[model samples]
Target: MADMQKALRARILGAGIVPRVIWGRKVPQGTALPYLQLFAVSDPRPGHLKGYNGGRTTRVQADCKAESYAEAKAMSDALVPLLAAPATVDGIKFGHTKAEGPQDLGEDTAAGFVHRMSLDLLVWHSSV
Candidate 1:
């Protein structure tokens, strides 16, 4: 298990994604452990309308852990540039999750952590 974790971390770091490995916590029944989460913002190109990835991707999160901050930052940096150009992907908005509290906020709250990232990228990319 340790070796496998190391290998996965290496791959993620090599890929240049903002990798964050958080310990798993217990959840309700049927819940899985060690769920890894990933997020990425994307821009929608003109051609994407015909495909499944229609609009600009604001955020993409998956159920998995990343190795470190370098890896996760790398992924975010790689994606930041692409968003300014043009492309389509299947990603969620910053606050698309069902979680309450910090995850969910009212309009006046001014985008929280997740939304801030998404909105900032969107604004930057849109300006370009």
Candidate 2:
């Protein structure tokens, strides 16, 4: 099977809402504006009673961080429609992507402080 986490991260970048994306890590100081930080919202491999299907479902949170709230929300808004379209990235085929909760987080005052907007995602994928 294709690497699910990597594929998901790649997909977000490939979506082109923002080219700069970091997966499961802290962004360094002075990184570019309007980047995305991705984190798992649910276990990548949950217990499935029906043995292994060729595909897996994973949930992730994609955060849009920018110096301004408008920029952050705009980047996130761009992603909402893009996620709904199915596409293949890397070695993985995205069967579906659904987004939830733009959960307006106003501003964060730590680490790489910025106005942040986050979306919870349900991703369905398989190795192609």
Candidate 3:
């Protein structure tokens, strides 16, 4: 699972897309940007969380700058391989979901970045 997260993060940052700083702010070139928190949900085991269903959340921030729509797509494209990759352990499946709430890129003056992402996993042991 950790590998999957790392891979996803690397993929996104490697895309070379720089995001605009909110509404219309200019971000300095060559400036180091903080990573975005990436979330992941793990499959639930039987009796674990008792009837809560299969769900988990993990977040990892990445550093990158988005300057165009294609750049955004490059970031978005990283999601697929991450979701496709299965958990290291057996009887566990995982996938990624988009974040919820408002987004401010890198500004917290008002509310900063407010994205809540979730992943759904199925536990094979549940069938037992």
Candidate 4:
């Protein structure tokens, strides 16, 4: 099975909207403005019959951070379409992505303004 989280990070980075894309619980120290941070919320395998292959649905939160709300919104706006487009990342075929935000996360004392988006992606890949 592919590491879906890494695949997601690659996809976003390849989009070229931001210079920095981090995939982990904590953002990198001294990171510049206009970067993306992705964290996996959950990955649950659905029920399947015998001898059947089942894929996992992953829920992820993508945070676009910048010095201001406008910049964060712009980054997020560009991100949505990129994620929505159909493509395969690191051999992981993406079935689809459902987005739930561009929600204003307000000011971050350390990182400045933050805008968040949630994505529920249907990932289909062979089981290991």
Which model scores highest in TM-score?
2
Shift of residue 93 alpha carbon in model 4, Å:
0.5
Candidate 2, number of clashes: 0
**Superior candidate under lDDT, 3 versus 4:** 4
User: Model 3 RMSD to the real structure?
Assistant: 9.7
TM-score of 1: 0.25
Winner on lDDT between 1 and 3 is 3
Task: Kindly report which residue stretches of model 4 are placed more than 4 angstroms away from their true locations once superposed.
Answer: 111-128
Count of clashes, each model? 16, 0, 19, 0
Prediction 3 global C-alpha lDDT: 0.35
Ranking 2 against 4 by lDDT, winner? 2
Q: Per-residue lDDT tens digits of candidate 1, residues 9-121?
A: 34344444433432224323433222233333333443445554332223233333123334334344444443344321222122112211112111222222222111132
Candidate 2 has its poorest 10 consecutive residues by lDDT at 39-48
lDDT of 4 by residue, 68-91 (tens): 767778887887777777677776
* Candidate 3 lDDT trough over 10 residues, lowest sum: 119-128
What's model 4's TM-score?
A: 0.80
Alpha-carbon deviation at 8 in model 3, angstroms: 7.7
Superposition error at 16 for model 2 (Å): 2.8
Listed in order, each prediction's TM-score against the native is: 0.25, 0.82, 0.30, 0.80
* lDDT for position 4 in model 4: 74
Kindly list the per-residue Cα lDDT of model 3 for residues 37-105, writing each as its tens digit.
333334333345456444444433332233333443444344444434443322333344333322224
Which ranges of candidate 2 are over 4 A from the true structure? 44-50, 110-113
Candidate 2 lDDT tens digits, 1-128: 22777876777676677868887767777787778998876755545698767777778888898888889989989887887888888788887688898988866565555788999988888888
TM-score of candidate 3 versus the correct structure, residues matched by position: 0.30
